[model samples]
Target: MNKLIFLLFFAVTSCTTFSRYSPHNKMESCVEGYYCIVNDSLHLKYETLGGFYFANNLKEYRKIKVKNKPKFKNIIFYGKSNILDTDYYLILNNEIYPKNFYFKETVINNKKITIALNSNTNGTYNKDFILNFRLPK
Candidate 1:
């Protein structure tokens, strides 16, 4: 009976589960201007930007300006290649912003990408946020 109880406790307490979006491995290297986070055993890597550009069409890239320079734009992206259908959040001024912005994925590599938010607003840019990523257990 004691052994059974111990086994049950071990199974319940020793089992570790990772977050839904956790990375497969720990973030070995982070960019100079970036930070990482682990939530529920998931790695979330992100960075903050003052402003960015967006192209209306994916085939043709065009630069559009915005009026209100975002106080800060939080970017959360994947660290691995062949990632599909990943959900990330972009926070601006501590508030969740819309997802109408455009993103450009690098064809040569899957390391990084540029996102343009609020193409209609124009002003000074200020970035203040650490990019975080979740790591798999």
Candidate 2:
């Protein structure tokens, strides 16, 4: 009787957990150096970065790390101008096009990166929305 009850309980819990979060079981795409997930439901991509250097002074670079993991359904393309070690990077968000957003300040706390973007009057980003990004591992 004890064995029967234990098996029933285990089966019920396992079914509930699996039903709550359905698995995609889709294959991931790793072409060239970029990794992507494309299916009928969602699409996301990840690209390795070289660096983001200032055009005026190539000697200095913007210390920014691209998150290697994709958690949302968005098309992200991260790459440098050239394959050279001194290449610079530029991130473009398709949601907010026409106008561009620049990095005002960046804070690293508890292994997480929080980027504060400079206000662009012509941009579509709302002032109330806070942008938080995860660093590359």
Candidate 3:
């Protein structure tokens, strides 16, 4: 009887915990070197980085190299010449995204770097949205 009660309790607890985690609703966003997740939805909206530079000019853009991970849906580059006013171009699955932004002239020793972007999603221009990027080795 004791064993039966314990099993019943365990089953109920396990089901409840498992139901909270959903693989189908995850949301992922990758900027620079950082990847952000919302839930389980895979479609991530990307934004361009304005005024981002390496040395004297903007850092050139590059292809995303993700290993042991799912393929990205889109990539874009917003040139610094426009700076805070330029919009990013969408790079679709079949198309290649160009690396036109300038990187700091200094040698990048890290494998990844995170960058934050201004958030206008709320229509009030809140400064909370951050875009993270992963730099290549």
The lDDT leader among the candidates is: 1
lDDT per residue for candidate 3 within 13-98, as digits (tens), equals 55421112123322233456333333223233323232332111111333221131211222222212233432222222213222
lDDT of 1 by residue, 1-137 (tens): 99999999999766422222333323322445433333222223333331222121211121232342232233322221112211223321223335653333221122332333333323323211212222323
> What do the candidate models score in CA lDDT, each in turn?
0.30, 0.27, 0.28
Lowest-lDDT window of 10 residues in candidate 2? 16-25
Stretches of candidate 2 above 4 Å error?
A: 3-9, 12-23, 28-31, 42-137
Q: Pick the candidate with the highest TM-score.
A: 1
The clash count for each model shown is 18, 0, 28
Please write out the lDDT profile of model 2 over residues 1-137, one tens digit for every residue: 99999999999655421111113212333445332322222222212222222211111222222432211112212222332322212232223222233332232221111222333422242222223232222
| Two-way lDDT contest, 1 vs 3, winner | 1
**What does candidate 3 score on TM?**
0.21
Q: Please give the TM-score that candidate 1 achieves against the real structure.
A: 0.23
> How displaced is residue 3 in candidate 3, in Å?
6.1
Cα miss at 35, model 3 (Å)? 2.2
